[model samples]
Target: MSELHNHADRVLSVVESSSAAALSRLAASWRRSLVRHGIDPATVQGPQRLTQRELNVLVESNDSFLRSATPRVDNLYALVGQSGCAVLLTDARGIVLQHRVNDGDAEVFSDWGLWSGGNWSEEAEGTNGIGTCLAERRRVTIHRDDHFIARNTGLSCMDAPIFGPNGQLLGALDVSSARSDQTEGFNQLISAMVEQTARQIETDFFRATFPKARIIVAGDDTREGSLLAVDQDDLVVGATRLARAALDLPTEGELRPIPAVDLLGRSEESPKGFEGAERAAVMRALSRADGNVSAAAKALGIGRATMYRRMKRLGISEKSH
Candidate 1:
């Protein structure tokens, strides 16, 4: 039997099996391709390409997203281009918006439909890198025969999903190579770079969405790029997808304006009552005045006697200030 027929048989057996619980990610994707997407594992057709008019419409609609992603994509290409890889940026639907390929490898990549305007959604192209990554909304490396389709078994693709500022699925960043010599280890390394670049693009897009808001690193976990956008009034205006998940905030729609201190759990650590507010104000004034009673009173717009009496009522020692 031919290799393509062998691959098709393998896919059919897995999809028809009842061991759903034991399926690996690749197996699950294969099942999805065969059952849900109705893609034939032995299919030899390339990806669907959009016309110039349709491509133009998509580009115009995603202008801001393209603007934010172009630089990062270029940087990633610079890092991996000489390795005979083609770098592609796709929309959330897995439509290729932009790609960078070396002159020597352009013909091969183009033939594989790794160019702009190619529709690579899992529903359209089976379980390839860009399609599977977007479908799963995570980082993935589809190496060689791991691909669901026999025709794509020659390629290795590393991809990471990019989320928008509002925690929406933006698209994916992909690095693909048809090099027969590319090993899984090298693909793993490129996967890390692809994930990192995708994250940088997410941060850039998030920051751009709230240009005037203060961007705060919300948590110590740097992998998700947990960030919050704070307004002048100290209200959280926006949060990245990981930040939302970490903080138990809504993952979509307009985030309710939450106090920065409350969200950060600082309010519980500090005072809460009206007297507590007064005490805090007094302490702040005193600190600003270098603990000078008269200066602090002047800063507070109160008489020195009143300031001293309030300090005593608040249980603040003169020496502690």
Candidate 2:
């Protein structure tokens, strides 16, 4: 037999040799163990019938060039396959389109008895992010006990609602995982996975809408910052000198007025002052303000609200002078 085949056979043999009682006890132990890990019992949302329009659109998108370029967005379940989390994708109509459980996680998740075609509405799944985002059409993160199901209290999920060309509600994307890692901060891993999935979706959208364009306007993009695109909007639909000032892009300080689009393909292998500039902005502003936020706001050419919000977002805090 081929080496790969032999490997597979060995794995199968190991699995097959496992006793039936062992499996039963394992399943039983996992049921409550997952609960202790934060699987909200009440919010164990399953799948539901999708609307005709929603199904048609998703089916088309699933077969589009975007799918060819980036399969994970539509291959929602596959992305998180057996990683101890579940990835769900829904349509504009609150119908669940695709669902996938992380590898090795299927057994634990199946304990919640959440299957395909389950409805996750507050009326059904209650207050959970996936169902709630679909119901409210917003981005949300649902943690333990937030789910309607008391037994589902062990799961934490981060979800974001998607949009189409018309800014129409397209669907919801989410990552659901056991809350055991929350103490270790690896729960952030799930959030990062969701963000990557979102980025792929956005990238596909950009490629489809502007096939000939090289620039991308990924708003608040993660690679470096936001992306810039040059459409026929007449106005420069991208970052301004203020943004350049905030990020302290060294190239810009050198008199190069790089638009957001220019940075799309620019990888962060070089000394791109992302971290330094971010910290410098506060230091420079605070220095100018002598630690007075109101003064810093004026000097930074932003509103006080904007200044405070940035500070909070950046984890910067100081006593008001």
Candidate 3:
């Protein structure tokens, strides 16, 4: 009632007479159109769930697969890595086999869980690349609204299925990025690249791994996880209930996956002293300060001279910023 009253006021107040025909007409019949094109609303994804045991199985299980497959997985990673896109390989059961991501993508891509042994299917994660590709054994474009998680509404993923040596359904391979609303040509190009990668994997699997030439393989492969959110420095910021329970972080702002020295430089003033959650925030703060002594000191609540001394000790410099 309040909304209708507001819309009616633009035409005239209740005090005004019916002499205003144009205003009356607009007020009487103005309605919003709610339709979409090209995309099928039924393209919604189905429910999916992956237990910690499953993820642990995937991580521990990859070495054998990698050993058998050899550099083909490496080549695929190199190919996808060429485009600066995140790539993942998943088994027929939707368990992630291999994940090759660029060093520069960890910040925006904190959610590597999408391909980390989680379920990928229309009925599982929604109309996603890995899931649909697994089901269709073909290529697909899973755009933003097509995601199950709200935070993932900004990503787009392309997926293709893979085959084993004896024509068995091996898994799916995928190329994913946050900015997929690119040109139609780009989408086509992504699909083509994914197909090529799948072929390369098949080629490698056959010539090197498989002894028989009679085997033919077919079709397809992510995004989003419940892992806790961490700052670049690896400090836990916010986490999903699932993440906290899975990783066992004591607090919301705690650290789970500790940042390595290469990614987050070791602290100088108190690298060993700053334990628990403090380390992630401190590293992130220093990085953002650009190694500026004055800036970092202020952020850390220490003196500028102290900051420089700390930087010298920590081995992190302005260049690291």
Candidate 4:
């Protein structure tokens, strides 16, 4: 007859009757929590937390990731901290590595185990924001009673998965609010911020991973951060997850050294005969010379008059540059 029992009964009914494919993502997560993880919806226990020593080891191993993510975590906190939200960054396994909360709200979040060292993996904490986002490898907003566990039903969590430069699952960025007044609309806005911040963290991590490589924005829409890292030889040394998915490139491990031009669909090898190749060569020389005809001809080891004749034949305008 209590609200907790009501919640448990609702979860049990959904898990028992609804097929996985027939349920919405949230309901499917509830089923996963109940069936796969064997979580009791009425359980009152908080999430498991690693000991200090274990947390230290995990932090040391993820040093670079935390370093790349910490600043963004602080920035996101600055944006949402006053709204009574706690910002947390978790590793791929949903172990919290960094946590930021205002002093006034720290105790509340800490009591709920939303602090560094807390493990919120789907296996440990069931259907919640950080856990579900990492489980699905996407953005998720678990608002209030949408949580699978009755104890967690009072919290609203927004999370986004962060992918590494190697296109591996890095972790998730989460913002959790314990405010009873939090609405679904506000959570939606916070979810957008979480996703954007996650993308920025990914970009920073990618750039740091290839400090000396030239970063190319490979797509028109930059929100996904579709980027390619090219070495001095113009070989693509790395790619973001979005870039890999868009270009049909391998998603993990060492990327094969593919030519950037080939990936961009601008290969210099011409199907059109020698004339096309010659034109391409002439264009390259002109580009390298910054549109100076004499310099381009000198670089090509040809007379200026010959260069002019070739440009005319190639139908390249000198003023086009």
lDDT of 4: 0.87
Model 3: per-residue Cα lDDT over 112-137, one tens digit each: 35545556544444346676677666
C-alpha positional error of residue 231 in candidate 3 after TM-score superposition, expressed in Å: 56
TM-score of 4: 0.82
Q: Score every model by TM-score.
A: 0.81, 0.46, 0.46, 0.82
Model 2 misplaced stretches (Cα beyond 4 Å)? 1-70, 74-82, 102-116, 135-139, 178-184, 214-321
Between candidates 1 and 3, name the one with more favorable TM-score: 1
Ranking by lDDT: 4, 1, 3, 2
The positional error of residue 197 in candidate 1, measured at the CA in angstroms, is 0.3
lDDT of 1 by residue, 1-321 (tens): 399889888878877777863278888898889889899899888889999899999989999999999999999999999999999999999999999999999999999999999998999988999999999998999998888888888999999999998899989999999999999999999999999999899999999999998888775546557899876445577999989988888887767666567678653223467887777677656655766889989988999999889999998777654
Off by over 4 Å in 1: 18-22, 267-321
After superposition on all C-alphas, the RMSD of every candidate to the true structure, in Å, is 9.9, 16.8, 21.9, 9.7
Model 4: per-residue Cα lDDT over 1-321, one tens digit each:
388879988888877775653378888898899989999999988799999999999999999988898899999999999999999999999999989999998899999999999999999989999999999999999988888888898899999999999999999999999999999999999999999999999999999999998888874536467899876445577999988988888887767656567678664223256776676677667656767999999999999999999899888789643
Report model 1's TM-score to 2 decimal places. Answer: 0.81
**Clashes per candidate (backbone, < 3 Å):** 0, 33, 16, 0
Predictions in order: lDDT: 0.87, 0.51, 0.52, 0.87
